[model samples]
Target: MGETIDAGGVDLWVERRGTGPDVLLVAGLGDTAEAWQAQLDGLADRYRLTAFDNRGAGRTPLSEEPLSVPRMAEDAAALLDALGIPAAHVAGFSGGSFIAQELALGRPELVSSLVLVSTCARPDAYFRSMTGFWHWMAERAPSERAMLEAFFLWVYTPRAHADGTVARIVEETLAFPHPQSVDAFQRQLASFVRHDTLDRLAQITAPTLVLAGELDLATPPRLGRVVAEGIPDAEFEVLPGEAHQPFQEVPDLFNARADAFWREVGARG
Candidate 1:
């Protein structure tokens, strides 16, 4: 079960499990805390895993104020403070990676290590165009089902689509209640477009790992490389035959690598 916590005037729905050192998982754009289900199942056995719905996602209510990456980062930090956690190993996917980058830069002492999956340091023309198209589709789609179906095309690989994986995902997504509203999604897209940290990555002191899906169209391998290069001594790896949601597509591989990284970071501390 999840509980609501007040973080920087926003009430965030957060869930926690297992025990040991803390690990915070931040989800991608318009994603809920449930997005990290695989990670929770895989990592909670060895670590105290926490996941939360970002503002305007899941059960969290939308804020009237305009959203920004730095503000979201502050929300994460405030969540930690509310939980009385001094620091944690932080992992983020896609847009959450942007928030993670901001969190590390703004509150280095609160992040023990960083895992950025399917992320970019800055939005390039390709990213901007892709997101723009997504926004356009969301705005024009006849229903939420139509919008989700269109969105999944860009998130999963051809193999997933060919193997019926995407279809299953689409079913679940369509069935999910409290899905992101059109207005909230537009705000998220705007924040994603404005996200930029290429020049400030060097200031991130946490041990960082950047992972990219070999077949990810949005935030492709090249973008992941840019993020890795920007961060000082950050490790970069690519998962073969995976797309945006590698953790969902290949949980065993994703969990194994993530476990190893966290273990190594724990040992170092």
Candidate 2:
């Protein structure tokens, strides 16, 4: 089957594998459908896994229109509609978690359940400063490698750094054909900084699981706590000795946690 789908005005590149209960995986800032590679590999055996590139990432073109959380949530909704899915378990990471929250609130029926990973309710002063610094680095970094190197510091834990996982990922990213442009990275970051759902999170009705990494410096456990507290009945857990991108860092454990939660949600319904 073809990869790209006409999601409203944008052609979003999507990949689907397996054929059980539907699962939609949303990617984070400067990421593509490829971000969920681990999930697809680990959990597709038991679920229909669909992952896609957001606007300005992967095969999705960087539209002239500025990106926003609600707009991207609409994009996700469009993908589900076009695919003929009534609802699916949704899992999102980092910036993608913001998109998941908005999607659940905006189109509650489209989301059967949600797993928000390394998410925050709102950006704090430090968050703002870090994003601002990344914005500067995106434009001023001597090379794309340097930009990625800078990003790795916050995305992965020291364990990954010492274990060659970080280097392997950097090489793979550099080798990937559809790399996100500096402008695209900055544009996504722009929308991310503007996302604020702290006051409105209570409206999310879907079964929710919020997970944070103990070592996550970007959106710390405290930030993830705020999100969990806002959403009534949303379960929150902190993965010990993990970092921001636990999905990538420890795919087996991450996959088990998400798969269990999703199955429980399905069983309850």
Best lDDT goes to which candidate? Answer: 2
> Candidate 1's C-alpha lDDT?
0.91
Give a tens-digit lDDT track for model 2, residues 113-201.
Answer: 99999999899999999999999988898988888888899999999999999899899999999899888888899999999999999
lDDT of 1 by residue, 143-246 (tens): 87788878988798898889998888878887898788888998988998999999998898999999999989898999999999989889999988888999
Error of 1 at 257 (Å): 0.5
For every model shown, the clashing-pair count is: 0, 0
Q: TM-score for model 1?
A: 0.98
* 187 Cα displacement, candidate 2 (Å): 0.7
Off by over 4 Å in 2: none
Q: What is the Å distance of residue 26 in model 1 from its true position?
A: 0.5
Quote the positional error of residue 186 for candidate 2 in Å: 0.7
Candidate 1 steric clashes? 0
Model 1 alpha-carbon miss at residue 100, Å: 0.3
